[model samples]
Target chain A: MRPPPKSWPPTKGSEPLPNAPRIAPPVSAARPAGKLRGARALSGPLPWLLPALIMLGLFYLYPIAEALRLAFTDARLFDQATEPSLDSIRRVSQSAALPVILQNTLVYTVASVLGQLGLGMAIAILVVRAERARLRGTMALRTLVLAAWVIPAIANGVIWQLLFSEAPFGAINSALRMVGFAPVAWLSDPSNAMLSAVIATIWQGTAYSMILLYAALKSIDPALNEAAAIDNATGFERFWFITLPHLRAALLVNAILILIMTLNMFDTILSLTGGGPGRATEVLSLFAYNTVFQSFELGRGAVLSILLLIISLTLTAAMVVFLPRERK
Target chain B: MTFRAIPAAFALLATTAPVWAEDLITRNRVGPADAPNALTFRLTAFDLYSADPATAAHFGDLFTDFILAHPGWRIDTQLQTGAIAQEQARIIEQTRAGRGPDCAMIDSSQLATFKEAGLLAPMTPFFTQEQIDDLFPFVREGVTDANGDIAALWWFTDLRVLYRDVTLVPEPPQTWADLQQAAEVVAAQGLEGILFNAGRDEASAFDWLAHFWAQGGELVDDTGRPVFFEGENREKFLSAVAFFADLVESGAAPRRVTALSSYDDLLASAVAGSTGMFIGGNWMYNQIQITMPPEQAANWAVSELPGPTPEQRATGTGGWTIAALTDDPAKTEICAGIAQLYAGPGNAFQGLLPTSVSLFEEFETFAGPEFDVFVSALQNGRARPSVPIYPEISNQIQILLGNVLSGSMTAEAALDEAAAEVMAAYERL
Candidate 1:
C-alpha cells in the first residue's frame, strides 16, 4: 500500500529494501573447504578397525568355512571307517520325515513371529495410551514378561514339563481333574507335545519382540497424527498409513531375529521330548543333535546343520529383499 | 579398584586349593600312609538310581563305613545322572583326552566296549586270584573282557522279578500258562494283569529279551548271528507276543502300554494302584517302598518270573560296575582298592549285593525277609550276553516288539523284520 513495497532493484553493495526482510543468498550448496578438511581429520583414526576385523576373521569366518566344508564330507565321530562321502546328503534327501520337519519348522517360525509381533504391538500401544495413574502397573507387567525371557532354556523346559506332565500328580492334570474334566496327556500324546513346546517358547520369546517394537511405536511423531486428523482421516487409516509405515524397520529386524532363533532352537526340544515316543516330535535340529551326540555320526550331523543354515539364510535374505526400506 | 579387593575376591579359592590338594595327595597314598577318614569318590549312575536320594545316601554311607575299617582307605561320594549313550561318550572322550576320573560306575554290558577302547585297566593285576574267584560266575563272567581280563567289579546286581498284589491273587502264578490265566482273571475283576515297558528303545529291547530268553530263545547261535526269529525260538517268542496282544486287545492292559517308555513311569502306574502286576528289577523294592503307603506296600510281594516251562526259569541279570581309568598303576591300584572296599560284604548298606561269592555269604544275613525273593531269583538268573553290538541289537528288537504289541504288525512279521535288521547290524560290525 505504501508505494507498493518499493518495487525496485537494489543498488550495488547497498542494503536491500528496508521494508523487505533481507533474504540471505542461497548457500553455494556445497560444503566449505574447512568442513571438508575437518571431516578428513575426523576420519584419520579409522585404521584402528583392523584388529577387530582380524579377530572376526579368525574366530567366526574360519569356523563357518570349515563347517561348510565338513557338511559336504562324511565324518563319523566313532566310526573311523566312515570316509568322506556325499552319502550324508543323500540320506537327508531320502529321509521320510524331511517334508514334515520342514513344514513344522516353517509353521513354528511364522506362528511365533506373528504371535509375538501382534501381542507386543498391542501391549506397547496400551502402555503408551494408558493414563499416568495406571502406567506403573503396566510397567511392572512388562518387567514380568522380560523376566521369563531371562530364564535359561533348559530350566524353562523342565518347568514346563512339570506343568504338563501326563501323570495325575502333575500340576496341570491335577488342576484339570479338580474342574471335573478328564485329564489330558499334555506331553506323552503326540498331538499336544509340539503345541506345548510352542507355548513355552512363546512365553519366553515374546518379551524380546515387544521391547524392540515398543521403542519403534513410541518414536513416531505426534504431529503426523494431528495433521492426519485435521484432514479427517479415520484412526485406523492413520495407524495403517503413518504408524505402521514408521514401524517397518523395527518389524523387519525383529522378524529376521525371530526366524534365526526359531531355526536354531534346540535346548527346549531336547529337555522336553528327547526325540522320544518313537520320534513323534523330532525337529531337524534335534535330529542333527542325535546323529552327532547320540549316534556319533558326526559327519552326517554336520551336513544336516549346514542344510539348516542354508535354509535359514535363504529365508533371511528373502525377508530383507521384500521388506520396505525406511524413508530418509 | 584397590589391591585389597583383588585378594578378597580370591580368598575362598585360595584357601580351598590347599585343602583339595592335601585331600588328593592323601587319597592317592596307599597302604599305611592312606587317610583313614572317609574320602569322597564321585560315581555317575544311570538316571534310575541317581534319582533316589535315599539310595544314593545309603550307598555313600556303606562305602564310608567299609573304608573306615581299613587301615589306609576311606570312602566319600557324589552321584551324577546321565543317559547311557551320553555318559559313555563323555567318559570315552575324557579318557582319550587323558583327563578321566580315577574311578567310575558303568553298566555291566559296557564292559566289553570299555575294554576294547583300552580305557579300562585290568583289575586282576590289582586283586589277588582269591579275590577274583570269590565273585559269582554270573557277575565275574559279565565283567570279563574277551581277553579274560576282569575290567570291572560288580556292585549292585539287578535281577528281574515278578511283582504282584496278593489281594488280587491268593497265590502267585508258578508258570507262564498260569500267568496268562491269572491275567485273564485279573482283567475280569477290572484290574490290569501286567505292566511292562514296550517303547522302541533299549529298555523295551531288554524287556523283550528277558521273555525271549525265558522261552528258550538264544541271542546268538554258534555262527554268531542272532537266532531271534528262527525255528523253535520264533514260535515260542511269537506265542509270548500273542499273549500280550490278547491282553491289550481285551482291555486287560491300557493302550498306552506301548507309550510307557521309561521304567519309572511303569512303576508309577503300579504305585498308583492302577495295575496288579509288573516286571521290574531289585531297585523296584525301594521305589515301591517310597511311592506306596505302608498298607499297600505290605500287599506287594516279589516272586520269580514264571517261564514257558518249569525248567526254563531264567531271568536276565544286570548291574553296575566300578572300573579304573588312570594310567598311573599306583593310582589305578588305589582306585581299584576303593572299589573293592565299597563292594565288599561289610558294605551291604550301599543297597548293592556283593559280587564276591565269599563276601556274599557274609551279607546274606542282611537280606531281611523282604529281600528273600531277590536272593532266590538271583540263584537262577543269567547275565545278558555281553557283546559290543548289544545296544544296537537291543534297539532293533525293541522297535519290532513295540510294533507287534501295538497291533501295528503281526508277531511273525515283526519278528522276521527285526531278525533282518539285527543281521544287517551284525554284518556291519
Candidate 2:
C-alpha cells in the first residue's frame, strides 16, 4: 500500500557509479507489462517442447477420442454395419454378470491397495528404525522386497501360478502334503481364486508404496521423535500421532496410483486364473478385455473402458480434495 | 596404421560385416537370381514345431525347395502363435487393414468366419473341378464358402480318439457301457479313470463336442438354427453332459477335472499315472513322445472314441487348412502350388494324417495301427458347424460343461441354460 522502505530497494548514492546494482521494483507490485515479460521468459523452451506435445496429442489424446467415438456405435471386429446406437451401453447395463464383475473389481482393488499400503508402511517404518550397524542387511532386505516389483507382470503371474498350481508338483501343495495336510485348490476353486490373485498383487505392488513412504519417512524431523521419546510416549503413539500425520501426502499419492493400477490389472489376471474356474475372479478389466478381444464386441469394450475412466477420475478427484495441504 | 585408424577399422567391420554375411547366406540358400523377393506366408499352427519337430523340419525343407523352384523368390514362414480364437482375430485385423499375408495356414473350423468376411480368395481359379473333387467330402464341405466355392485346401487333419494305458485297461472301450465298466475297474485300482478338459474354455468345448456328436446330437438344424434346445437333440445333449458328471460322481475321474484346461494337462496327468484314459487328438502320441520318459510313454495306446453303440463311431475333425490371401493373381497361383505341395502325398513321413485318401494305404505302413484307428474315426468324423455363431455356441457349451463338472447345476438345467444362450447368440448373428 505505502512505498516499501528505502532500504528494501537498497539505498543508493546520488551519482550512478559504473557497475552499480540497480534498484528493482518489488515483485508483488510489478506492472502488468513486467509480468508479461516474466511469462515470455518462460516460453524460451516452447519450441524444444513441441515434439513431446505432438507425441502426447497423437498417442494418448487420439486413442481417448477414438474410444469415445466408438463407444456410441455398434461396432464389432468383423461386422460391416456400425450404425450409431446406444445398444452397447444398454447391453452393458442389462448384463447379469456386470454387477458381479463390478463387485469383484471393487473387492480386488480395495484389498490390494490396503494390503500394499499396510505392509509397505510396516516395512518402511522398520527400515527407518534399523540401527546403523544393520544398515547393510536392511538395505539388502529392501532390495529383495523390490525384486518382485522389478520383474514383468506376466513373469510375476507365472511365478504365482506355479506356486498355486493344483498339480502334485505345485510348490505350495507339495509343501502342504509334506506337513500332513490336504492340498488346497488355491486357484482351481472359486472361493480361493480372488484371494490368490490379491496376495500375488500385494507381493508385486508393495515395493512401490514402500519406496514412496520410505522417502517421506526419511524427511520427518528426528527431533520430534526424540522429544516424544523423552516424554516416555509409546512407539505406537509416536507412529500414530507424528509419523502417520507426516505421511499423509505420500499415502494419498501412493493410494491413488495403486488404485488405478489395480483397477487396470489385465495381464496378470490373464496369465493367472484367466478370470475363471467359472468367472470367480472376473473383474471389470478382464470382462472388458474378453468382450472386445474374445467376444469381438469393440463397442461394449469401449463403453466399459469409459466407465472405468469415470471411476478412476472420481477417486483421483476425491483424493486431491481431501488430502492435507503442505504448508509453505 | 595409427591407433585411431585401428578403432575406425573395427567400427567399419562391425557395421559392414554382418550385412555382407547375411547377403551371402541369403544368396546361397535362395540361389543366384535378379533380386530375391520374400513371399511372407503366415502359419497359424506354429505349435506344431514344438509338438512335432520332424514335421516342422519337413515343412521348412519343402518351403526351401519351393523357393528354389521359383527363381528370384524366397519364402518367409511367419509363425503367428496364439490360441485359435486369438489367431483368427489377428487374421481379421490383417485382412481389414488390406495387408494380408500372401498365404496362411488357417484352421478348418475358422474357414466360415474368413469366408464370410471375404478375407479368403476362391480356389476355383486355381484347382480344376476334378482336382477339387479329389478332396474328401467332409474336407470339401468344410472349406466351401457361401458362394459354394472352395476357399481353402484341406491339409493334414486329426480326429479325437480314446487313449488308454494298455496295461491298465487290457481292453479298449467300444461303447458307453464298456467305457463305464472299464472306468470302474480302473478306479478300483486306485487310479483315476479318465482325464479330459471340463473347464470353461475352448478345450472343454472341443472335447465335449466329440461326445455330443457320438450320441447323435446335432448343433444346428437344416435352416442353421441351433437345434440342441429341442426334444431329441436336447435329450442327447443332456446325456452327453451327464456322462462326464457321472464319471466324477462315480469316482471314475478326479473332481479336479472341473478346472482342467487343455490336453496338455491331460497328458501331464496321464504321465504322472493319475489317470488311466483320456480323449485327445492323434497328436497326443507326438506330445507324449516329447513330454514323457520312454517307459511312461510306452504305456499309452489309441483307439476310436466309444459311441452310444459299438457300430456308430463318431468324432470331430479339425486341423489347418491352407488359404490364399494375396491380391496378386500370380502370387495367388504360387500360394496354391505351395499349399498343394505341403498337403500332398510326398511328406507322409511327417506323421500327420494326410487328407488325401489315396495316400492312406502308404501312410498306414509307417503310421502303424494306432493311426489306423484315427483314419477310421475320420471316416465318420463330424465337422464343426461352419458359421459365424459357432464360436459363441462353443462358449455356451463350455459354460454348460463347467456347470455340470462343478456340480453347480443339474445336467438338465445346464443344458437348458446353454441352449437358450446359444439360441440368443444365433438370433443376434
Candidate 3:
C-alpha cells in the first residue's frame, strides 16, 4: 500500500527543457493521485511538500477511500472480499432494529444538548454574579464543575453506573428511599436508561458550556451594566436584556459542538448500559461499532458509518448558516 | 561489510523468518527482539485470569511453572474483557487485523465459526492419541472434526444452576411454580429472590434456554436452522419466557435483574445476603469462596436449575477451549502441552472443573457431597449449537430476553421477531 519511492535529481528521463534547468527536480516513480499535476510538472515546492502530502494521503485519504470501497462490497470477519454490490446497504435498511437505534440517537443528542445548555447557563450566571460580589468559594465551585469534565469518559461511566445501581445498592436510589420515595429502576427500564445516560453526559459536558459563556459574560462592558442599573433595571431585567444577547453567539457555538459530540458519543454509554435492556440505549455510533467490531459484519458497519457521517455533516452545515456574521 | 558475505546473510534471514499464512500477512510480534534466548508468543488471556489477587497468584504460579519447564520461552497474554461476548469479539477482531494471538483461548461456542472461517487447522498432530482418548465422551465428540482430527482441546467446563441460602429456603425449588412460591415467601420477608441474567448478554439466553432443553425442546433443527418457534418447540419457548416474566410480574423478582450481564454480579448480590435464590453458574461458588467469609459462603447452595415441570430437569454446559493459531509445528506442540497443563493441573486450583474424565476421577476437591448436584446434572446437560450461524441465533435470543424483561414486547412478539431476524441472518449466510 505504500506509494512508490521517490528519487531525487531526475536523471535520463527528465522532461523539463534541457537548455535551462532552474533546479534539479525530484521525480515520482508513480503518477500523482487523480492527475492533479503531471509527473514531471510536479516541480517547485512540491518536493518540499511531498512528506506532508504523503502523510495526508496515507492517514486520511487512504482510510476514506478504503471505507468507501468496503461500503459497496461484501465483507466479513476472516472472509475474503467479494464483488461490489448493495448487499450491506440492503442489510442495514432491512434491519428490524434500525428505527429504534435512530430514534435513540435523536433523543440522546437533543436531551444532552438541552440539559447541558440549561444547566451550563445557570452555573455560568451564578459564578459570574458571585465573582461580581466577590463572594467566597467561587473558584472552588468552578473547579468542582471542571473536575467532572476532566475525568476520562470511561471513568465517568463507571462512577455514574455505580451511583445509579438499583435501590439499596444504588447511592441515588438509597437516598431516595430514605426520603420516603420508592426505588426507581434507573438503568433497567428503557426510558430511565436513556435519561440516565443523558444526565451523565450533561454532567460531564456542562463545564465546557459554562466556560464559554463565562468568557462571553466577562467580555461585556462593565459600564453598560452600571448604566442599566442606573436605569432602574432589576437583576432579572439585566440578565434577560443584556447578558442573554451577549451570550447568544457562545450559546449557538456551544449547541452546535455539543450536538455533534453527543451524536458520536460512545465510551461512557458503552460502559454504562452497553446498549442493553434490549438495545434501548443504542445510539448511532454504538450501533455501528457493535455491527463492525462485535458482529464482524464489515460491510454493514461501513454503511452505518457513512450514514452517521452524512447526518453529522448535514447538521453542521445547517448550523453554520445561522451563525452571526462578523463585521467586514 | 564484505560483498561476498551478503548472500550468506540473506540465507540466514530466510531460514529464521516466520512463514506467513497469506498474501504478505506478517505475523505481528512485539518484545525484546534482541534477547539472545527467549522468543515471545502472544497468547489471548481471559478477563478472569487476574480478576482477583488470589486468582492472579494461582494462575500466575502455572505460568511460572511453564517458564521454568521451558527456559527462553515467553508468553504474552492480553485481550481481557469483562463480558464473554466482548472477549470473543476481540479475538475475531485481532485475527482480522493480523495481530491475533499465537494461541487463543476462546469460548467453546466460537469453535464452529473459527473452523468455518479457516482460522483453525488440525490440532491432532500436537496432541497424543492417548491424551485425545482421555477427553470426556461429550468433549471428545465436541472437539473432533468429521475428518477424525482434533480441532481443539477444551480445558474446562461449567454448568448453570440455581443457588439459594439454605436457611432462607429450607426446600429447594423443583418446578417453576415452586420457584415462584418460594420467592414470594422470601419477598414477604423483605428479601430479594429468584434472580437470573435477563440482560443483553449470552447468559440471558444460555441460562434460560436450559429450561426448554430440559423438556426435550429443540432450539434448532438438526441441519442447524432455528426452529424454536415451530410446533412443540414454540410452546416450550413461550412457556420458558412466560414463567420468568410471571415471576417479575408477581413482584417475586425485581426488573433490575434485566441489568445483570455476568454471574459475578449475581455472586456479589448473593454475598451481600439479600438474595434468597438466583440462577447462576457453578463457578460462582468458587468466586464466593475467594470473596466471602467462610460462614457466609457456606450458607449458599446450588441445585439443578428448576424446570417448567418437576419431572423435567436439565443443565446447559458451557466451557472455554484453547486452539493453536501458529502453523509452525514446534510452537503448535508447545501450545498443546500448555493446553494439557490447563486441562489437568492448572484447572485444579483455579476452581474450574476438569475436562478430562480420568482427572475428574482422582480430583479430591470435587469429592464433596455438595458438588454431587453439579456432577449429576451433567448427565442431562446439553451444549449450545456450535454451527457458525449460532451466534446470530444467540444474539437474537439475548435481545428477546431484554425486550421481554423490560416490558417492551410480549413473549410471542419477541420470539417471532427474534426468529425473523435469525432466518434473515441464515439467508445472508
Best prediction by TM-score? 2
Candidate 3 per-residue C-alpha lDDT over A1-328 given as tens digits, one digit per residue, 9 for 90 to 100: 9865543434456564456555644434444665545644566688889999999999978887887888897676656457898988888898889999999999999999999999988998899889999999999999999999999888898788889988356789989998999988998999999999999999999998889888888898888889999999998999899888877788889888888888888888887877878888989999888776556677888888889888988988898887788999
**Candidate 2 docking band:** acceptable
Q: What are the per-residue Cα lDDT tens digits for candidate 1 across A101-205? A: 676666666776677777777777766666234656787877888898899988887688768766546688799999999877565455566677777777778
DockQ of 1: 0.14
Model 3 TM-score is 0.85
The residue-level lDDT of candidate 2 at B311 comes to 81
The residue-by-residue lDDT of candidate 2 on A174-228, one tens digit each, is 9999999998878766768789999989999999999999999999999999999
Among residues 3 or more apart in sequence or in different chains, the pairs in candidate 2 whose N, CA or C atoms overlap within 3 Å are: none
Each model's iRMS: 3.9, 2.2, 2.1
Docking class of 1: incorrect
| Ordering by DockQ | 3, 2, 1
List native contact recovery per candidate, as a fraction of 1: 0.14, 0.29, 0.58
TM match of model 2 to true structure: 0.86
Weakest 10 consecutive residues, lDDT, candidate 3 chain B? B19-28
Evaluate model 1: give its lDDT.
Answer: 0.68
Identify the leading candidate in terms of DockQ: 3
Q: What's the ranking of the predictions by lDDT, best on top?
A: 3, 2, 1
Decreasing TM-score order of the candidates:
2, 3, 1
